[model samples]
Every structure is written in C-alpha cells, then in structure tokens.
Target: MAVEFMHPDGLLQQSDYAPVAVGTGSRLMLLAGQAGVTPDFKPAAPDLAGQVHAALRNIIIGVRGAGGDVGDLARLTFYIVDWVPEKWDEVLAGIARAQQAEGLPAPTPPITIIGVQALFTPDFVVEIEATAVLD
Candidate 1:
C-alpha cells in the first residue's frame, strides 16, 4: 500500500502529521474508540501513561483481530479528558512501549487529538480510535 501526504499552499505545514493522507488499499477498517479498560470494565492502569499504554495495546489487538497490522493504520483520533500538553511525552512513551512489546512498527499515522471535559466514566482518561487499510 502507498500513503501520500499533502499540504496545500497557504496552510501550515505540520511536522507531526500531514493535512491530508491518500491511501491506496483494497480494504478499510474503522475501529471503535477503545478505552484503557480491562475485560471486567475496570481501569487498566492507574495513571495516564499506563492507561495510554493499555489503550495502544487495545488498538493493536483490534487491528490484528481485523486481519490488519499496526503499519496498516492510516489515522488515529484520540479523545483525552483534562489533557495537558506536557503529558504528550508520557503518552508517546507509553505508545512506544506498547509497540515494542507487540512487535509493531513505529506509528506514523495522521492523528487528531481532542481535549474533552470527561468520558463515559470518571476513571477513563483517554479514548483512542483508529482507521486502517489492508490489501
């Protein structure tokens, strides 16, 4: 599969992501917003970093279950409650750890992060949704 990123003139060039991503593939996968929760509906981790790791793990699980690999992911949408800009370092670190554990490639998908007041529950801090493609 081939993915292309384009930034039109007059638009700010984002180093982390492109304004548009054009992907060529035969199949598309849209995953639900996965929270950092266990099968028993309990918080998977007590802190933000841990929760982020757990959520990333869930994303890998979902993608693989759909017969897609982490590299197939084309986009990511993250909804965070009471988000702090400084927390990104920890969040990214957690993601890195999860990817390493799962033997997944370093994620380079276009991502959108939204800061919200709350989620489905008080214990939930972050929710991650994904879009993937498969040939």
Candidate 2:
C-alpha cells in the first residue's frame, strides 16, 4: 500500500482538500458521517472534546468493519459546532489521543475542520467523515 500526503506544510491548507489521493485498490469504503452517538444511538458525551473522541472511535469501528484500518484512511473532514479559540489546545490534544488509540502516526491524514452553527442532532457537538482505501 502506498500512502501519499499532499501539501506537507504544517500550516493547515485552506483548500477544500489537501491534494488528490490516488490508490490502486479494488475495495473502497466510504464511511457515513459519525457523530458522538453510541451503539444505542445515545450521545456519548456532552462536551466537544468528549464528542470528538467518541466520533473518532466510531469512525475507527466503521473502518475496521469495512476491512480497513486507520492506516488506510486517506482523508478526514471534521464539522465542529460552535468552535472557540480557548478550546484549540484541548481539541488538538483530543485528536492526538484519538490517533494514538488507532495506532496511527502523529499528524494523521489530511484534515479539515469547519465550524458550523449546529448539527442534525441537538446533543451533537462534532461529526467526523473519513475516506479509506482498502488495498
């Protein structure tokens, strides 16, 4: 499997995506947007960080179910409701923990975080979407 990271700069890329991700894989899994909702469809947490962690966990499970691993993740997009400057550090730390749990390297896949007014659910604070290549 070949993994290519586009726009290697540390500063977040402002484009809709980092760069075109090409993979010679027969199976491609497109995971649905995962929120903090749990197995029982209950909000896993009330805070942003907790919700972020839970969402990432759910995403990993989805990837595994599709015969893929975190390493196969090619792109990640995040939608955050009510983003705040004071919470930046906490958010980054939570992301680090999530990547660690997946046994993935630091500065994981190309990511985009957008602040929105609200999500489909009132209790949801964050949602994560991932695209993976299962080669």
Candidate 3:
C-alpha cells in the first residue's frame, strides 16, 4: 500500500476505479510500454484476447523485476492498435485470464486506453505502460 487512491466527491466518479493516485514510495518506476510479445520478442498470440493477456503478464514481469508486485502499480495505460469500444469485452476477458494464470491482484489503478494505428510491429496488437512505486 504505497499509494492513496482518491475519488473526490463530485467529479463524475461513477467508475469502479480511482481517478487520481497519490503515491508515497521513495522509488518510482516508469516502465516502458510492454508489448504482447514472448521471451524471444515474438508475438505471444494472434488475437486481441491473447495479446491483451500477454501484455498484462509482461507488465507484471517488469514490475516484479523492479522489486514490486501488481499492488505497487499506480497507473496503467493501454495502447491498442485499431481499438474500438466493442473490443472492450475482449480486453476484460484477457485480463481475467491473466489473473487466473499469473495470480495478479486486481489493482484497479487509474487507467487510460488509447487507440493507435499501429504498435512497434504488426505482431503486437497491444502495449501496456505501467507506473509503479516501491520501497
């Protein structure tokens, strides 16, 4: 618990997540956008569902390598190539699958999703940028 989540009284706060996060850790980690790639930098899956899961898993790997877990994450940004509102369902399903596979806590950090024309490569369908603070 290195962050304080704030959802002020009258700020259109109907969403399940906090709009602001105030962190207290001394060390801050700004992770680069993690793509849905495998160990050898290969695409983990062919579809959005599998790519989303792989991307989240990669975020977890990055955070853990920096001595923190998912709880230490203060924010997450998702960049999806050719994203659409209807694709949100697939995103949710992927996250659920990742949680089951990686045992990641549902941190519910403040988030932003962006639709991009493309990522670093065509193989990666999604990339996730994570911000975390640690002791």
TM-score per model over all chains: 0.82, 0.80, 0.88
Candidate 1: how many backbone clashes?
0
* Residue pairs in clash, model 1: none
Q: Mind giving the per-residue lDDT tens digits that candidate 2 earns over 1-135?
A: 434556656755644334545655667778888997889988988887778778888988998898877777787788888877686665676576686775543556777788889998889988889888887
Q: What is the Cα root-mean-square deviation between model 3 and the actual structure?
A: 1.8
lDDT of 1 by residue, 1-135 (tens): 444556778887765455666778788888999998897889999888788778877988998898877777788888989987988887776677776786544445777889999999999999999888877
RMSD of 2: 3.6
TM-score of 3: 0.88
Candidate 3 lDDT tens digits, 60-107? 899889988877788989999998999988888777778789865454
Candidate 2: segments with Cα more than 4 A from true spot: 6-22
Clashing pairs for model 3 are none
State the lDDT at 7 in candidate 1.
72
Candidate 1: lDDT of 21? 61
lDDT of each: 0.79, 0.75, 0.84
Stretches of model 3 off by over 4 angstroms after superposition:
12-16
Highest-scoring model, TM-score: 3
